[model samples]
Target: KSKFGTDLNEVPREISFCSHTITGNKAHVVPDLSKDSRFVDHPLVVSGPLARFYAGVPLVTADGYGVGAVCVLDTVPREIAPAQLSGLEAIARQIMSHLNSRNLLESERQLSTQLSQSKRQLDDFFDLATDFLGICDINGHFIKISHSFLKVLGYSEREFIYKPFTDLLHPEDVEQTINGFISLESGVQLGLSNRLRAKNGRYVPLSWNLSSNVDGLVYAVARDMTKQYELEKNLIQAKEKAEAAASAKSRFLANMSHEIRTPMNGIIGMTSLLKGSIDDEVNIERLNIIQSSGDTLLELIDDILDFSKLEVDKIEIEKQALSVRETIQDVIGLLGTKASQKDIAVKYIQSKSVPAWILGDVTRFRQILLNLLSNALKFTERGSVEISSDATPTDDGQWTLTFAVKDTGIGISQENIAKLFTAFTQEDASTTRRFGGSGLGLAICKGLCEKMGGRIWVESYLGQGSCFTFTFNALETTASTEGRKKDPFAQIPTDLGSVKPLRILVAEDNRTNQIVISSLLKKVGYTPVLVFNGAEALELLEKECFDVILMDCHMPVLDGFQTSKAILQKFSDNRRPYIIALTASTQKVDIDLCFSSGMDGFLSKPITVNPLFTALDEVYSKIHDQVPSDRPIGIDKNVSLTRKQSKKQD
Candidate 1:
């Protein structure tokens, strides 16, 4: 072909001689292009540039792709030497090697730029994070620390770097910190907490999470726990203070109850004794007034104590078989005097669905009815009060009984009904002034109803009477109702001539209480030996054998509990006297304590003729081996009759 120029550089592959060389792995040589059959019609030889001789070598890449060729062409036909073709192949390989190397260098430059940008982003993130981030060397030295770590310790980066990590720890925490680091080095992740000494010289609490790599460097994240620790400490202190206050309140209530009930018992007991002997109608009426006022005062004290017990969740519910109708009748009888004074009629209606006997807390049940009936009678000056009861059966074999007390008194307003059940609240300030009350009666009733698995509510309107309703859960029981209706004094003979003898002993420290108890026993044909205190009673017991010992709980010398326990230890079951506890305190805890101290029965004082006769009859029944008509409150009939022989010995 002609001399190489820019115009020939643009030849298309289909008519180009170099295209043939590029198709093979080696050089292509045409000694005479006109004589070669494959190139006989070649464009360059026929017209453009008549070439008689040609030689070319393929420019193959390292991966064996032939892109183009290096060639020599001449117009005159000539034979190509082997040496010449080898020289052309070497030139083609050298050109391919130079192109490959240049492309690789450009790619490496781009990669280096990307890596530099990534490193800058990581450094920015490390400095900007708020959490305390740090790295420690194998020796527990701070090799790297973030800005947050330096700021929290009040130290500059220069002062913290390369410093021992434990240097900032509280003296009490250094040993644990060292152990934690050692654990981290053994491929264990660690969670640690310690107090760190800050620049202000005050120790700051910190919580940390640490991990280690094979490079012997520890990576850590920490949080300042100063506020959290202080909060926890404050919460603990508050809880302790609350417990102390509660304990103090309980002690105060118990003391007040004992002090108040002691005088109340005397007032009521003496009034009862005075009434039995007086024949004048005016004097008897005056005595009744005195007894009624004393009962009102005692009820006020009970309300306060009950509310306090309920507030602290200390009131316990007792399950016993009780007659629903009898219990209601008893409550009605209790308020009957008040109703008579006001000239108001009191009625009770019982539905057939209400079982005769149901399992429940009889005392609390009576208390609820008493509170409701008392309120109704107090408000109704001239109208009638009605109490109705009905029961609904549940699928679980239990019964839900509902009782309602409707009064036609000075009716409550709609707004006042909302506040009726709240403690220390009444209809208004005028109501408190006119109708005196502690305003805790309804609240106590609510608390009692809930304790018995029930709820209480009221419905009323202005100028209309109010209706208070309550519901409780109970199980149907087949308990006998024979003795429950018997008169408590039925066994005591009116004429003392034919009375069975009982050797009774009364141990009371108070002079008035001793006289009142002795006179009551005498009235019932029982002549009891009297003593001043529990110690005196124990002394008398050592010298005499008595059938019954009525022990007062609180006295000057040895208390009744200690005296009872001593008696229990000194005498065998068959020889010990039938001990009965008499106390002014009516708390359940106190009653339980009485029984635990080996007393067979308990009686709350300001003793009256009925309960006093009941207790004596119970003791006599045990002695004579006859089942009395009624058992006294808190008497355990199942107590072994081994003590029966004590009376025979006496």
Candidate 2:
């Protein structure tokens, strides 16, 4: 081994496994071999090819703890600079930093893979959830629908995404939900339980809870309420049937009261006049007592029917041209009388912007206002009732004429205010006992206001009085045209020509009703041919071409349906005689049947002369194609129906 390095050209060759040594780590350096005794006698030191000046450092760990290093080599002994050694040290530090970074990166890669796996599991769980999840934009277009929602609706996510949320809702619920959603967007929360149509065209109930995500985005959770809703609906239907029977009984009572008092109105009126004619004060007092009792009975009947109609949802919106100011005046006048009796003053403020003409269901609006004002009057023994109205623009390019009826009366408690609009409810049971009412007045008012596309609310303090405010969206029209078309009850003729009497056919089974209808026809200057049943009426129609046929339903020989069908088949021509239905039934199914059978119109049973005339005018006048002749021009049914006669008087 000592002679191994003796050859000048021979080199000691050994290979190291660590690759870092490949890059200059094997280089050798020898400095001042002449001064070194260790190499003085060595042949390698004297005659070897490159081992003269040796200076080396071991390459170490990545922390710069040296294991090995590069060295310089030369045949002759030479000096190396301190600056060069510092440069080599800097290179070693660079290599160490690189190796350490690589080791740390590999550790992070493994951790990231584990985290990704965990996230995938969570996503899978959400995908498998039973409750449906969905997200929608503010415009109500679906951004995403859960697999469960798609499965329930029989649709794919591809089909539902980007579609309007309202598209899946039942047609009747679409507007309501949309309106609710709009309110929600304005910081209101909407928890909706509504009907949604399935692909098979059946409706299923869905409950939804929604939260706003980012701007203009909403995340919603929904659950299928089909089974629960079905049970609820069945229960509702049962309740509705029971309510309908009760309503019918109430209506029967009202009818009896109306029929008895109708003649009694004449009797009481005549008897009172008779008592006046007589010089006996005792008889007069007795007659006054009798009239008062009848009046009280009539009032009681009205209260019962109002409550029943509200419960059963039988009230329909009736349109008439009414003077807005006049209606308020009438309500105020009635309240003012009560207020005066209590030594309280009543004031009405009319805003200048309030239009003389308006389009609305007059009877309902007036009833609502009247109920509120009367409540105010009843509660306040010594305070004023103020009715006022003003016009303003609604956001939808429409105008709202708001009516507020404020009263300095016994204010309502905050807790009881919410219950005021509930059916058969007052401030409390005690309130109903103290005040004479069925407790359904405010409920009717709420329903009526909503039907008219308005809302009623109240603001009050406990000791101070209350203010009832309502907003109505009224259709606008030109003043001249409004005045000309407003009146529905005016007697002015469409044409000045002497009119021939209409040959009308009256189909009725009841003898008293037949005579009553005949008398009404005679009063209207029309000669009507009376038939005992629908079959007889149909036979009469075939025998002679009548101007109109007033068909009654539920006859012995044939019902209104069969008779209508037979008549329709016979008169297949487009220009058939007007078939007006006279029926006690006002069910949706019944009305739809009449419409489908080509009936021109329907009149409710126990028809008065006014409604009968109105229906006839609506049918016969529509056929005339010009202005309706029976109802005169410039005579608004609305104003007359809602406004006081005194308000219209010059």
Among these predictions, the greatest lDDT belongs to 1
Model 1, 118-200: lDDT tens per residue? 86876676699888888888677887778877787898888878988688888999999999988877899999999888788
Colliding residue pairs in candidate 1:
none
For candidate 2, lDDT tens digit of each residue in 309-384? Answer: 5556765565555677777776676456467788877777878887776766765676777778778888887757
Identify the runs in model 2 with alpha carbons over 4 angstroms from their true place. 1-22, 25-322, 330-347, 393-398, 450-453, 462-464, 478-498, 554-557, 574-576, 584-590, 618-650
Every candidate's lDDT: 0.81, 0.65
Estimate the overall C-alpha local distance difference test score of candidate 2.
0.65
Looking at model 1, residue 523 earns an lDDT score of 71
